[model samples]
Target: MKNKKWFGLLFFAMFALLLAGCNFNSSEKSDDGTKKSGDEKDGEVAQVLNLSAPADVPTLDSTKAHDAIAFNVLNNVNEGLYRQDESNKSVPALAEKHEMNDDKTVHTFTIRDTTWSNGDPVTAADFEYAWKRVMKENGAYNYMIATAGVKNAEAIMNGEMDAEELGIKATGDNTLEVTLESPNPLFKTLLSFATFLPQNQKFVEEMGDQYALEAENILANGPFKLVSWTQEQGWEMEKNEDYWDTDNVKLEKVNVFVVKDPSSGANLYETGKIDRVKLTSALVDQYKDDKEFENVKDSGIVFLRFNHNNPVLKNVNVRKAINMAIDRNGLTDVILKDGSTPLYGVVAESFYFSPDDKDYRELNGDFNKGTPEEAQEYWEKALAELGQKEVEVSINIADSDEMKKVAEYLQAQLEDNLPGFKLEIKAVPFAQRLEIEKAVEYDLSLSTWGPDYSDPMTYLDMWVKGSSANRMDYHNPKLDALVVAARGETDLEKRYEMLLDIEKILLEEDAAVAPLYQRGSAVLLNEKVKGLVIHPSGADMSYKWAYIEE
Candidate 1:
């Protein structure tokens, strides 16, 4: 997926108006099996939206949710300080009002009087507790470093200080104050992210480790609340009556079923069992001309993460050789025919914004792209340096249908292009694959990252030596310095330049990770479904404003 900033103010205003009419009243079912507005009543199936998920929700814990499926669900069931409107712009959600200092180093938010599903008032302390929890080492939040600019956040995450010493404070029940070590233009947008969503401090303490593990244990302060989650079977979310904007929530219930098979999902959509389904490459061509067919662009990049600690992969020459050998064009155009584009840089296209209104990619063009001969030369040098005739390495990948196809193609490409490298593919389930990455148990893992926000720093800062997402264990003092300097640099042009240089060092000079392609999804949505907002990054889709015409 790729992140695109919201532009054209007139366009967004019109978009908001289009969704403003989405609110549905307590309607009655007509004799023709259709909804009709009438007197308010309970136990009525006036509206219910059905969708299919490729995988089950791995973890609903706000701090631990790293997958798209979990993020989508969280986006609906939780309310943060802010949220993305119909046009992908951050707007106030739980926080009624927010103020930033002139230098943009400090922020103060006034929380609204919103009640949780359990009838408890949501307070500013909830936000403080949630943010502090993520900064602690025991939290293991994957994207904690994204907000490391918060004063003492780095110290808290690195165990240099207690989480209590972190920069956020609850000045009052409704007031939250945050101090940043450096200016961050995207901090408000970061607040709209799932990881930044607040958790009730009292409820968390009561539940302890069992918090967010089951549907019943969780509480919601957003448009919807989880009614049931049956693991692999499915989950049901009903509209939250206690939501501050419950009147704007149209759907009475959103039923999401886990269907791993694309064909099964397509069948469900066709048979009127599901309202939306994503198409596989096999089905993309078949449905491309249909009116309901929609291909959504995302600010996500898929790549190969080389474990720098791995014996054979520890060689820079070997890493570069693997980078040069893979045919990204073939991988995207052939193996992935679902509109995914080849990517040469770790940061996906259209995700970075430049102050001078110039394209960052134009300033710093494509990173290392080498031919077969160049790959062979590096492989030979690597073999000689390591004093090994040939080395066997495993490539861990998700066992999803699309992932399996890509893994097989990569395996063939490496074996054929780099002669001395014996590539072995290990395909595992999506949840197990994340565990393998966390444990650093794979030599080379097929991985993908969607930005937590629309900033270049979101993509660039992950490889800074000690980041939890830096599974490769890549460490370069030069690369680290550039990223750190970029974060504190207030001048937008200079900060972008620093980011470009950082990408050069990681993608070209050191070959810290291999870039493959930027992701795109081909989906079939029932035309009756409206107000379904698609984003370039963060949550893949938002159903807050969604409603069915039927």
Candidate 2:
């Protein structure tokens, strides 16, 4: 992940410069049967709409996906029973209706008649099988721990029961019932996650353990079907004419190209080759004057991760010192010229379960305001405690130009602020950086997290005990206990209290991670595009409701 503060600074700078002289003009009307600039034609169909992103989709398998790029792709091919809307509220997708028992432990779902691309009738059994596979001990699903409801789910995942006995059950062909050990307040939100999406049991059994191993084996039940994926070239999705709500789908095809370079993406958008492109700091200034450049708020948190297992980073004082040294505001103002906001807490700013609640913003205190004097004091204390004459650390970063700028800036800041401290920076490709992080081979790293669901737990629970994502091995028994308690507490007030306490402890006392900022996505879209919805969770591209102007 690039330094979000810097990314924000760069974006803001570009936005400020662009708005200075640009006219906020209304979209022009189109004629001659072609779509008008920013206006949709009355009866035209977009044969293909091209889109671009910084990162390539890491995996097509929803169970194994842990990154935003993968989620963007898998969301098109698979969908859960429920989905989060623009307001971050849960809404029905595959399920027609649902009810909760008195105790709220049992959930009965009435699924709509939907079929997979392979022509298999989707049923309750499919959900059951998919849930069980994820809760299995060796399941590849990244958020499988959230599957606390399946029969013997916790026990089976913990190696105590047979994996086949997990809690999901198919009462009938179209009816499904799930029994959780306790009431899960975020149950509906969890259903919106990719891990809970139903899969074809027969298909998985026939393919063995490698089901959905490639484009050929996968099945889609969403609005679009995967037409083809040519690796590095691009992936194509055609609107599923067989979709249950096909009448609402307007785009005939969605063509996505894996453009890693932001400059090239901006150029493509300018030339009208692609319908949308993501603008980075490098290209923000050049296109800020264009009406096509639209600023989008993304619920993403960029931060620095310390390898707690590393001998050098294992020192709490050292971590705290580093956190106090960086100028977060400067990074946000200088590096990111977009609408990025500096973040003080683990959760991103304005992120909350309730749309009306402003508690997260109010509770977020300044933890990383760049106090060089305080950082120097802590550095001296850390050096003395370690019995070392000097302190040195290397930060492993991604190979993107934005990341390189961030790493260099941090190196200068840390080295200049604290005497006898040396900062070394290493830039590596994303894949290589992940391998190094997995091996606990780096002292510090740059990373970001986009929510898997619309819950605070989605951001906080990754640090819980036995979590695969807790690569740093940050052991906070009290924090772990609080997270576990919050999971079972259905009362909204109590859960909020628990989360606030956890955040305070993690941000103020432990300094587990240094949060940089919350980012805004700059997506340049053609005037012809209409009904494009941007969800806060950054989950699916809801092109079903989207239509190209005719």
Candidate 3:
């Protein structure tokens, strides 16, 4: 498609790069939400940062990490060949230098002289071990390597080949090589994500089941080392002195408070306990005039994922009727009120542009156009075929303050528009919700996906029948074939045309996932909190260059 390597891009969207404030030595919030200062550590002031995570990371094992929180955590703790910079572009990280073959099928990286938190040498073998581990385990993010055009990756995933033959090797202690089936222009960008991060073989083997289970079990090669984790309350990280670029890391410690309630988070911010707080609709209005309010339109879409194993959801008409009954506009404007746009398709607006230089969403247009009358007609057909007058379904959503409101609105909309349809809303912690959804044990679940790389394929690839992230068990021969073709397609225009068809099938014809809204986070941020860059894709945020302006 494009000639640029994986580390380069022709476009970069809006990124939240903030700068301000004096450094704090080690700050903690007491029970009443006031700062507890540790200004002196070993006779010197230790620069500290205060932050927040809405939820705790389910797992730190890079292979099993699927959510933004986990990605954000792993991204801070682990080093890969590259890392995304302040402008949301890929740049060198662990690799001191790199080169790609003339044909673009083979890439090589020279590992920099770095050591893990435990003082073990970081080598190319670590990368090889980590990459193969994901393929062998068939974890959720293994699709990333396949989509990156790694040779034999698809074959291995299909059981046609072994992971050992997956075209990656440790040529030497410091030399790593990767062979791709085709020239994937975004391969470097793909490498920047946590899924591609290296894992220490010895440490992992020693820890066994306990690897990454707690802060002490994990090792850090990047700028931060997770030091403490209290799932509900919060987590903490310290500057990794072992990092190759440790001289540049500013903050001595980073604190992430887990406050699920939006108002509580805002309260924590107002009390000087946290640096940033994600605002709810009410909080957004209250703080709209405040100098701290920021509205960042993300390249992620929050949607209702349909479980295909559920009989009602399996019926195309039923799915179509359900989508039509929900008012996406009302959900975003009234319920969310966070500048989010009603999502009509699975792919978000800021992800990719076609060869004709048109955003995929702009080119594809809205697909959810069914009216109430049409929804009722489809519902009737679904009932007749299923031989049922009433259908009951449960929607599992994360226990976030905003979602609590949205769940009520969804129940009201579906019940009001579709006769005899019952919707039960269930709320759980974000980590638990992921576990339940993986079992395909619910009729539907509220989920969101941000692009791992800036490509339409990132959105389209997961819905394929056997994809690890395809917890829905969705299978369409036509859609499957289109995705397979698009993954390997080198012609930009042709791939664009195919993705257009794929999106239509997914959003309109099959109605696999009910589009909800493209998320826009309105937050209360301290202008003085500098260096932390918020990305539209991949990891949600990066703090490598973070420092207090003071």
Best-performing candidate as measured by TM-score: 3
Report the Cα lDDT for candidate 1. Answer: 0.80
Off by over 4 Å in 2: 1-47, 137-152, 208-210, 353-356, 368-370, 538-540
lDDT of each: 0.80, 0.71, 0.83
User: On TM-score, who's better, 2 or 3?
Assistant: 3
lDDT, candidate 1, 216-303, per-residue tens: 8899999999988877757888999899988898978887777787876775576556677888788888889988887766688999
TM-score of 3: 0.91
lDDT of 2 by residue, 1-550 (tens): 5798798668645643432232211123235432233323465443455676665565666666666766777776676788666465778888888988898788899889878998888898888877776666354453454544444665765678876776678999999998888887667777777777887877877877566556676788887887776555466688887777678667677767666667666655654556777777667788788777778777888888888887767887888888888887777668876667778877766667433475565765576455899998888888888898787778888787667877887888878887877978888877577667767688888877787776676678777656766667788999988987887777787778888788877778888888877887666788777777766774746666666665
Q: How many clashes show up in model 2?
A: 28
TM-score to native of every candidate shown: 0.90, 0.88, 0.91
lDDT score, residue 439, model 2? 70
Model 3: how far is 240 from its true place, Å?
1.7
Candidate 2 vs candidate 3: the lDDT winner is 3
Model 1 alpha-carbon miss at residue 421, Å: 2.1
